[model samples]
Target: MKPRGTFRNTALALGLAFLYLPILSMMVFSFNNSRLVTVWDGPNSPTLKWYAKLFENSQILDAALLSVKIAAMTATGAVVLGTLAGLVLVRFGPFRGRAMLSAMTTAPLVMPEVITGLSLLLLFVALEQLTGWPEGRGVLTITIAHITFAMAYVTVVVQSRLAGFDDSLEEAALDLGAKPAKVFFAITLPLIAPALVSGWLLAFTLSWDDVVISQFVAGPSATTLPMVVFSKARLGVSPDINALATIMVLVVATGVVLSSVWMRRQERKRRLEEQMARSDAG
Candidate 1:
């Protein structure tokens, strides 16, 4: 049993090491002063020059900013659309074409990204030819494509939450002369806020990291960070790539830390409020 336990621990360590070693290496290499990525001169090799160079790279910064803008827009649109779809599915009960709606909403989760990208490309081309609405493909096209896929994941998140939601809260609001919209706004929306937030974050992450869909829908005018990174990677990994990745790692880590702290504070505040209410009741 001890030997088995040791073996399990060793396996877990190896698994984690394998997953993180590349990231660790990237972080270390990002600080290297030398332009060549593979060279390890000595202990004093680490420097902040790459980070400085990264900031000076206007094209990479432009691409990163474009990606962020697209992600933000896509996440917001996905949340709104997803919430409406989820509310319809969960609250409205069995309706005509309910099965079809549900199927379509979940299909993106399983569909290959390449296939989805191709279909969206065809769709945008058709729309452009037929109406000339978009005229050309760029940020708007990329955003719409992202929203199309991200909305599916967001819908699933919200729909699952709504499915498990207690009907009593909304019913009570309605029983006390609240209209459907009022009840949704005052009661249901607040209750499902966490799901909405999760959905938005999920959508944003998907949009931010997407390569294939963006590649298909993106015009020459709107190059995304991932595309820039992929293009650079083809010529062999550069120190700038390492620096950019290290910065992203820092940003993600900071976000996680801040979010965890905020959640803990919120939890504490709720508990304190509960205690005060209990004291007043007594």
Candidate 2:
């Protein structure tokens, strides 16, 4: 038992190290005074110069801003469409083309990114020739392509949430004077708010992290952060790049910590209410 426990602990430690060691190294290297990202110069080599330079780089800053805008739009659009699709699939009950709708919504999840990117590229080109609507491939095209794939993930999250949801509250609302639309807006939406938040975050992350699809659809002026990072990476890892990654890591870590704390507080409040209700019943 002791050996088994030791082995398990060792395995867990190794797994965690495997996952986080690279990130830890990158964060450390971000402060290195040496231009060589891998080499730490001396004992007093830690510096914030790279971070300062990172802010001064207009190209990276512009790309970061553009990526944020695209991600925000993608998350919003994906959540709206995906939530509706999920509601139709779960709540509307077997309508015509139900299977087809489900299939289409999930197809992107299984499709390769390259294939999806290529197909969307072809689509935009054809649309350009036919209608000349989207005159050039830029922000609009990138956002649409992101929404198309990201919505699949959002739909799955929402569908799962709705599937396990107890419909008693919704039914009670309907039995009362509440209309369907009102019940949906007041009850259903609030109940599934966590799932919606999760879906939006997932979509935002997908859009922000995307490079292949963006590459396929982006115009000369619409390079994203990931694209810029990838382009620079092919040459060599730079200190500014490491600083940029460190900043992103900090942002993500802060969000995760805050969300975890909020969820824990909500759970504790819920449990306290449940115990109070039980005491009242007794």
Highest-lDDT candidate:
2
lDDT of 2 by residue, 1-282 (tens): 356988999999999999999999999999999988778987756889999999999999999999999999999999999999999999988889999999999999999999999999999999999999798999999999999999999999999999999999999999998999999999999999999999999999999999999999999979999999999999998999999999999999999999999999999999999999999956
For each candidate in the order shown, give its overall lDDT on alpha carbons: 0.93, 0.96
In lDDT terms, how accurate is model 2?
0.96
lDDT by residue for model 1 (61-149), tens:
99999999999999999999999989998989899999999999888989999999999999999989999978699999999999999
Score every model by TM-score. Answer: 0.92, 0.96
Q: Candidate 2 clashing pairs?
A: none
**How far does residue 73 in candidate 1 sit from its true spot (Å)?**
0.3
